[model samples]
Target: MATEHGIPKLRIVEPSFDSPLTSVIIDLEKLRDNRLDSKTHPGIFFQIKHIFQLLESLGSARIEGNNTTIAELVEKEISGSRNDDEIIGDDEINEIRNAERAMDFIESRIKNNSKIDQAFILNLHKIVVE
Candidate 1:
């Protein structure tokens, strides 16, 4: 049913196993369960995770019109040089950094058994904005 503002209210419904969508979901779950384990070392795993997080952050920034490229970001990271003559602006860099920080906050706060609630979402939003 629509609200007074004419926006339809969302309703939660139970999943039906006989639906085609349900079969696709089951197939995806099976694929996830059968995926091969990398068995990577903890140190290596962290390194990989950091790389992926950086990529995710950069992608987020790009979506928001931050024109920083992955190569430029990686160069800045590796060189550790924050000179005045840098190709990318500080704002762009900060946008990406903020996204990365938000991702880290999510990782730190969430776990396998954790329930994501409104408070957690608001806190996460604060982190991204601040």
Candidate 2:
């Protein structure tokens, strides 16, 4: 891979299945399968998914230097926006919102069996930027 400025971008390949990292992958997969197979109520599962989406948004924004806390995210979500005196910037909030929306968009794509490729990625990017 290469950067937009034409610099080569180093890609990290996954560890071989025989490596110690493979055990982590196996454990995670088993945990995921167990969660999916559990007899949780639909509403409870929905809430779990919602919470995870928030965390996903939080982590994504943090990578870009967004300092919004999970508590603030919940408050902003409840109020639909923040006041002028709020410490967080509008752009930061928007980034978090975009990340959350992107996750939803991906979920929908997967549900609809949409092709996952460059176009799909670009579409997600367009959704996030817009």
Candidate 3:
């Protein structure tokens, strides 16, 4: 089946334990298990996560040809102003906001052990495009 973007639907493949890449995967898992714990306070960690989400949204917008910089977005956000000129258009700002809304939708809908399916992806696409 084809997706809205005309790409083939994703097929989940199970990895064989005997594959040559198995050892590399096992090593990565071990590294993940041995990772150091964060020393930041929970509140600070949450703030950092929020900042990362904003950065991620900006990066996604940039990938889609939105040239608005992080500083421009942050300044607009802080000032609550929307007087964008030739450099940054309203559509560009809206694209970043839509990406952020998509992230929020994922956070609110998804939980531990939740399965992401085609419906979820389509809903996410709707959020990003709206």
In model 2, the clashing pairs are none
Tell me which of candidates 1 and 3 scores higher on TM-score. 1
Error of 3 at 35 (Å): 11
Q: How accurate is candidate 2 locally (lDDT)?
A: 0.81
The per-model lDDT (C-alpha) reads: 0.78, 0.81, 0.81
- Residue 113 CA error for candidate 1 (Å)? 3.6
Q: What are the per-residue Cα lDDT tens digits for candidate 2 across 64-111?
A: 888999887888878856542343457878788777778889999998
Query: For this target, which candidate reaches the highest TM-score against the unseen true structure?
Result: 1
Candidate ranking (lDDT, best to worst): 3, 2, 1
How many angstroms is residue 23 displaced in model 2 relative to the true structure, after the best TM-score fit? 7.0
> 1-130 in candidate 3: lDDT tens per residue?
7685887777776679998788888889889768568889989999889899889999999998989998888888788574322224478888888888888878877745456877889999998887
By TM-score, highest first, what's the ranking? 1, 3, 2
The residue-by-residue lDDT of candidate 1 on 102-121, one tens digit each, is 88778877745456776888
Q: Please give the TM-score that candidate 3 achieves against the real structure.
A: 0.68
Q: Where is model 1 more than 4 Å wrong at Cα? A: 1-10, 13-15, 27-37, 81-89
